[model samples]
Target chain A: MSKVRERTRSPEGDLPAPTPDAKQWVVYTQKREGAPFKWAGTVEAVDTELALQYAREHYGLDEACVGLITYEHGDSVDGEYSIGPLVPQKADGTDGDEWLVFTLAKRGGNHQTAGTVNAPDAATAINRGTAAFADGKACNIRVVLASDVHETTDEEMVIWRTHDMTYKLAKGYSKQVRSKWTRIRDNPAYEQYQKEDIETHF
Target chain B: MQNMLADQLANIVLMHADDKLMLGHIQSDWTGLAPILEEDIAASAMAQDDLSHALVLYEFLGERFKLDPDAIAFDRDPCDYRCCDLVTIPDEFDWATSVVKRWLTATFSQLGLHRLATMTEGDLGDRAKRLLDEQTIQVTHLNRWMTRLGRGSIESHDRMQAALDRLSSSAGMMFEPPDATLTEDESFCCGRDELFTEWAKGIGITLDAAGLSATITLPDRSTGGGRRGEHAPHFIDQHAELTEVRHSDPATSW
Candidate 1:
């Protein structure tokens, strides 16, 4: 709803709007369990926490996703500053930062964290990673620094225990109730007959 | 005794279904009109979830009450529907108010569903358990939006505070049951007092985390007529809109 407010001039006679501290985060979505994280889209937020909320609502809601992870675009370094395969480089034994490299095994499929690479920065890691682990169709690549990942403790994981309810599982309804028509006639081939009749009519 | 309990159970379920249907309709109103494209799509998805939940409950009620689900949902008069006033309040295009309302209603529903999932009596328990996953998703989304808006820009923060203050009066009525008898039923899992305590604690935690604890006062039992099927003024219009298509051609089939 719109609210009408009296115009009041500031001492500075209307200072320009301050720029937002929000950072652009690249979002990846795992559509289901065991699926790879695909580059879904981007969101602007102040931190990973808020970025997650935006990412979940924006990229995660449109599909049946199991999880979403986001990384700041600014976190990337060097070559082209985009998510993709990189040119190969000679191995220099410098013992650099550990970066987790993810790649799509096929075109328009899940982007899995295929392997890790030790390199000076994220760009080199992607380059080395793609050269090392890239299959024929490694269409997209993403690299995250190891330090960004958070681990959950056993105690904190307890909140996820939802009273052992199995109703959410489809298999929970595997046992079917006997149809009321069974009392009228015990026909083992009832389903087959119904299927044939429907097919014939159509 | 058994019949009375069954009737009470039906009433409780009916209230939930009605609340969901109304909330779902209100949320769908913002489908194309939300401030942002992402939020617009998200709200629409959540609205679909709410409607799906309502349909499930309506189907269950239809079986128990021996009526068609469509008739139960659309053909009833205003007094026959048992939704609370909190969900029935019009948002008047205020994004902040809608966010607050969605958050409060989702939290209340989540707690209620959790308790119902533990019920040992009937299939409602199983249904409640099944619905928990979707309910949790909606609650998390709404909760995040609530926090974001509450602590966002100065104007947004002010709007949120005002919405919370205005809506808090009837917020307590969410925990109110249709009758005193249902509370005592062990299968229902919780009484009004217990549910209220859990709800208050949960809400306090959420608000505190969002940094709005000191700014807004949580309203307790003040205005409540929803339990007896008395609705807020806006509910009639909502009911009309929801039933418009269904009423237009009662004899037609899609």
Candidate 2:
């Protein structure tokens, strides 16, 4: 038989609907003052207050530390966008690594591009830094590799990998402490590489 | 100084802390699950705050009584629990009812603490005063949610009010005394003989009158003595769930 016999599952298999009882949401916890937000554990709730309450009880208690909880929401914009629908825009299934580039600016100045982030695709790369944006500006933008601007090599953009983001985060208390900040001031280079290697969408 | 007061304080603290522990777990179920992102975060934060509050009381009780906090917290059967009937009722997956319960409970507790703050003596008095300070924060947060839902949408108001009517009879349960194994002589807990009546008459009356009425039917606690280890089916179910994990390896670290 021709290739018409070939079959594949739909992308819908990857994303299941939220259950009526288990309301799942990403919780961003502020563990410390100046650190960038690291991914915290997920929790269930019926609504916003209930979700926050759940996060506080599960993550905030037992440890005599201060923390804040927020239902990690998805968003979109110019330089910023939600990490969803990881649509790999390739023809022949040849994909490599794409890095997310961020340039943190202060007072309207040219934000010296922070660093390149590893991503499977351009859109995926852009999402790793979206939650940091506040107003109309990309709180952080792209700095593709050694080149400090929004440059992307054809090889880097088309490359794909299954490198999950989970391995990079710490296991326990350290991860708990890492979830507080809005941005990364240190180790910009490493963060840049990470943006390209993984897919992070809410 | 008096042993009776000490026992009373222990009982009071145990009840308060136990309620917080359970509610804290229940409240945490909402994390990342709320209808709105903003409200989700805010509510989660309060859950952490409540747990923190419980920890303080638990620690105090543990230290004063020379007992392990976890023992008192996880080891007790629901029948042995002294928490009022108000906190025992299941939220039944209803968010509005949960909020109303918290609002009403906090109001009643705040009143209890308020009266305690005026005590001319005793460490319990001092602790109550301190708790009162923190309790206000919870009171404000809960009250805000209630008013928001109460005044904003007609549907919201109706949902909350209906839940209130269904659970209205349990409000008085908060003031009722259990048949607690704790006695004035045992250094367990005290003052419940008339504390519920006094608290209702003194503070509850004002709160009920001040636009917070939903109708509270005080449980006839005299019929069943929970404080003395006589619990109903609801409590047994609760204890089974809460203790299942803890008893798995009681002597080991969780």
Candidate 3:
């Protein structure tokens, strides 16, 4: 047995008290230049910088995202989530700080960037955003201060590399792995393995 | 002189490849078990990046040496592997230790990759530049974790400090030459003193922000260690685990 395996593992005595959870931040990603940012997910982070970094590592690298934005969860005001498309309300106003608007197309779908509305506060921002972007197609309307929405700069746009990144993607290996498997196993066995892989692994 | 430079480059590349392979192997075990769900995904993704980066380096080495990349990665003898002891040490599933170790290594790797990227050699400079871009994500993520956990709470701060203290000794060994044949000038691809200075400056900024401190010094190159092909027992176990699948069916293709 190796020394590491043979050494008696000591019990971890008196584990430290758990720390409080970090603040939550919502993340959005843009697929390409001039593309609309879509809701990606949320991450727990201590601050905006950390949140954006986490988002880049988690959401930006998940696919081929070209841009990412994040805002503190507490900063955003979400309107009522309706079962059907929201009626275009007459809440037009342009009186204060700009708020970026995002609209949910369906109940379980992601929110996409709709545009921006000028309002004094979050509530007004949502109302004005709904008035501006909710074209009777959005299931929900959300608004956050444009200032609060931190974005990746040109230098920070290293989210996607120019190099071939297929190694991390399953599809990158699918064809090559399938060919290798076929060379070793029969067609039926290979097909069954591939099916199981898609069902179980994917 | 050219042959000597090539050997030194090969040695450095192998060291980095081995380090990534072991670190990725260990970290990948935490895929389903990280402290948080998002962290689990992020760590797993970074681990995948590490593994993929290792493959790229190995491919470069294979192209230079006329060998298969897979064989270069998995078929090496224990002494032929050049990963530092720091990467091979068991984190024992301790999140603080894992984060701290990765942060330290990532800082050093960023500097190393920067040097490699600047080289006039063939596609090596371009390849390292590509790897360096992805490596920025890992370093940034780890740096955030380090700072977050360090300033988080007393318990969190203490754990991070302890992890840094524990790994401080082994961390310097990353600067050791991977091959005995490498002269002082050849060992560091760039000058050792210059690399250490830049690396220390980068580490100092993160450590300062993280509210952490460690006494990480350059190890004496004359005193050989893991990069000199002398690995610890933990590395033996790690290598065994890493090669088990490859060894199971040496003739089979994955």
- The most accurate candidate by lDDT is 3
Candidate 1: tens digits of C-alpha lDDT, residues A81-199: 23453444454453688887777655556556666778787767777776766654465566778667322222212112123323333454332223334543566577778779999
Candidates by lDDT, descending order: 3, 1, 2
Model 3 lDDT per residue over A1-202, tens place: 2233343344578865765678999999999989999999898976788777778878877788899999988898899998888887778668999889999999989999989889998888877777788888998999888998999877678886556676556676787788876776777877898889999977
| Top-scoring candidate (DockQ) | 3
Better of 2 and 3 by DockQ: 3
Error of 2 at A30 (Å): 14
For each candidate, report its DockQ versus the true two-chain complex.
Answer: 0.13, 0.02, 0.31
Best by TM-score: 3
Q: Is the docking of candidate 3 incorrect, acceptable, medium or high quality?
A: acceptable
Q: lDDT by residue for model 2 over A4-60, one digit each (tens)?
A: 112222344454344355457554443444433333566665556545555544554
| Residue A55 miss distance in model 1 (angstroms) | 3.2
TM-score for candidate 3: 0.85
Better of 2 and 3 by TM-score: 3
Indicate the worst ten consecutive residues by lDDT in candidate 2 chain B: B181-190
Instruction: Count backbone overlaps in model 2.
Output: 54
